[model samples]
Target: MNHGQTAPEDRARPLSVVLAGGGTAGHISPMIAIADAVRRSRPDARITMVGTPSGMETRLVPAAGYALETIDRVPMPRRLSADLAKLPGRFSRAVRQAAEIIRAAEADVVVGVGGYVCTPMYAAARRLRVPIVIHEANARPGLANRVGRALGGSVAVAFASTPLGGADHVGMPMRREISQLDRAGRRAEARAALGADPQERLIVVTGGSSGAASINRAVAEFASSGRAAEAGVRLIHITGRGKEVLDPAGSPLSAPGYAQRDYVDGMETAYAAADLLVARSGAGTVSELAATGTPAVLVPLPHGNGEQALNAHDLVSAGGAILVPDDEFTADFLAQTVAPLARDEDRLAEMSRAALTSGVRDADEQMAARVIAAAEAGRGEGRSRA
Candidate 1:
């Protein structure tokens, strides 16, 4: 039960880790990336993921080749209501379920990437006296990560200015496809993969895993307007599953210079191929754009705690991207601003350079290192208590 060993051979067994996060691609993607990093560094390490049964993680975690454990979701109510009254009972049950999962996994460290599943995971890890490592992907910390931090979890943030105290700026952990992409070198191939002519100015639009209605309306209208075709711009629109745009005839949308997809599996190709990306400014999207040096027109999700806007601040301030409010990001803006900007090679190149200047491409490894260290420290503390 020695806790302070640097080498694997000094320990009785390989490290056992449990990662908790889900509900969206933002949380799950980073969690998976960190797990991959940890596995690469320590192939013998055992990794398990904990998420709510109904979260995207059920499909994503298994698809990523990790073991997954599910617990009932217990979202904290924001206001004084019936749901708020039931919170304690739900939270307690979830915590008990989480504790069983952690104990069964024999987790050395519990890593969380803020989501609905994390609060209970944090509570469970604390109860087990296991070290908790948290990755806060938003500039405005979520309630779960805030609670984890207050419980003395080692906190890391995607944004340097995140409000969490004593948090390290680790950027966002992303899949290697994006993090290691040489955008300039792979541009032609990536464009080809997306069926875009190498010379065509490509604008890639996405509202993340779940499509944004405002963005869909604006972009779809712009696409149907035929301006993009007239200007020789090619567009790839990922409308999210079941959120497809429709025409006035009440049929699926079809427009010149527009390729609509319900989803795209590997976004790195899109990042590489896109001359300009039009997307919501989630922390993950912002980090990917910066990492890949992709110029962008960011439309923050109009709702939420204003975090999406804050997430885009650094890149926008650095001249890597343009931020448009949801209300203002209209088809007119696309035609007037984004379409013209897409054709401006000089401006796009300059923006790409600015993006690269602020990019951090090694966050997965950085977070993995933090998790490993926390695991060792936790083990040492266990030895001391024993």
Candidate 2:
């Protein structure tokens, strides 16, 4: 296997690859990045994404120009209950649907980025003897990827501390726009684009696509407290769609140096204009910040098995970011921590340098290469079976 490059004998044969993962941007984004990488390496490759009808992948996958195949979502129940009782039957049905998709796509390989859909996809791929590659985007392994690892699939992880067995640290695959961002060069234009004062320092606050209510409320209260303006710091707050809208009337966030939007279609510009980030430490968000060399104050989500805190650990230890609990990330905390950080130019720059030290700019290419190798191996296995 020549890694990312298609094998000489296989060059004439168009590759068919099936990508599985969805339900959230964290899983879907990496899958899209790898899909783009695969398309760049093999323009003729037939890439099909498997997701549930209700997932964000339904829209995101089609928009990314890949064929999407839907499967029933079968969420695994953690405790003994009625849902647990229904698990086996739902899982079996989902696996059957996924197996049909794999066969129909003539998938040479199945790549899974952990989500509810991944469990069935992984099981189906294994049953069909298809090569499987799993990407775990969280620091702690999720249930689907954990099972994928146990099935002897090739595993890749965003963070080194991920507990998945046989995992290789491949870093998080970033979107093309973020990976190619030139923050220094685009700072002026980006600031202008977002209606920010050119000289004012900017802090970006976000909580993924759906937004974090706690982060939003904290920032809003901080804005109302008048500390951000006193420090001459601007804020760009992205409150996810359908969330409580920050009333611009009588709110400091509506003032000259502050801006609030429900969603930012162009995060690259927002990242370029930012001097600091105040957000949740989801795997994708953490990777993007590291890759962009942006300093941050990460408030991991309060729920969900403590994975978010683990995700932000290395960056915090490296001095690239500060980790605070969701409950502790209040207006006072922002006034004390974020205010000082924004005002201290030298400290912010140092943190930026530290962030870049741990970032992987070529993760998309690396993971794409791994997927290509797995596909080639699966083809060889199929031929041998024949």
Candidate 3:
């Protein structure tokens, strides 16, 4: 199907699209999903993504067969430290560099998917009079997108009801891999791959890559304390890089029966194995949690204005998950607070149903339509203005 401007007059053809921003899979994965949607909707639309040389996007983008243009733009400092000292000079140089990339790409529009690197790019796009838009994945805004949104012509958000009520509400986009799973199939797979105990409940603890020290400590303590076992729950922990009591090897817990790993690439399997998921409430994590229809206990990173907490709050309020304050996210509190839910099958089912109900299954495709529509509308507005 050919993508076109949804205007009353002539419906114009699709235009070239450029997606800029990446660091985490939260950012990179959504951008990629959006690109894929654009390609399917408008076959003639050429797409490119801007990524740093070292970020995961560098490998992910090329592997997906999309050309990546690298730019050396550093993130602006959030706190008043020595790093903040370089802001003025660094931003000045970044603006010029990003402007050059926009000119060379001859892009129709630039979209920033939250990150520090997008600062210079968006700044330059503003200066050059190019149409700019951005997608803020967090319930709380980031250092970059807060500034970028102030200057952008349009803004889209994951959780619309948050404090950032001004930007347009476009739900969180998810990768197709996570989107394809149905609850029945994933449950069976999760049971098999993780060796979940049928008589005992299962709790899956994952702290993304590099691991959350607090989450690891709390989960380990719970497993060791026998509280986890008392709940008739076996723990399956995904430690990004954190070392458990069994530090040398990545092993699941054995004291009360735990299965641990440094990392888990097969997320579909992990989600299926979990009766409850405990982890950081990152945008990607939230999207995947909703996609799989699994109940979660989210602890937002207590740093940086506590954006992760805000993200979690949005989901929790919707009845999909629970938000635990990172500082108070102790093993004692967890075993005491969360363990009770395991026995309450009714609440668990309610959470599972809520998680599935609120999910935006076709977020990528929906967002692609918005972006393409924006570009076409911008062109129309320009013509009218002229």
Better of 1 and 3 by TM-score: 1
- State residue 112's C-alpha deviation in candidate 3, in Å: 0.8
Q: Candidate 3: minimum summed lDDT over ten consecutive residues — where?
A: 1-10
Error of 3 at 103 (Å): 2.7
Judge candidate 3 against the unseen true structure and give its global Cα lDDT, from 0 to 1: 0.76
| CA-lDDT, candidates in order | 0.90, 0.85, 0.76
Give per-residue CA lDDT, model 1, range 290-347, as digits (tens): 9989999999988868999999998998899999999999988988899899999999
Model 3, span 47-128: residue lDDT tens: 8788777788888889878999887758666589987888788778877777777777655678888765688888887777
TM-score head-to-head 1 vs 2, winner: 1
- Candidate 2 error regions (>4 Å): 1-12, 244-257, 383-386
Candidate 2: 10-residue stretch with minimal lDDT: 377-386
- Put down candidate 2 lDDT per residue, 1-386, tens digits, no spaces: 43345445555678889999999989999999999999899888889999999999999888888878999999867688999988889999999999999888878889999889999999988888888999999998888989887887899999877777778998999887897788899899988887777788888888877889898888888886677787678888888887644565733346445678877777788788888888889899888888888889999989978989999988888889999999999989878889889879999999999998988788899989999988877776543211
Specify the highest-TM-score model's number: 1
Per lDDT, what order, best first? 1, 2, 3
Instruction: Give the candidates in order of TM-score, highest first.
Output: 1, 2, 3
Where is the poorest 10-residue window by lDDT in model 1?
Answer: 1-10
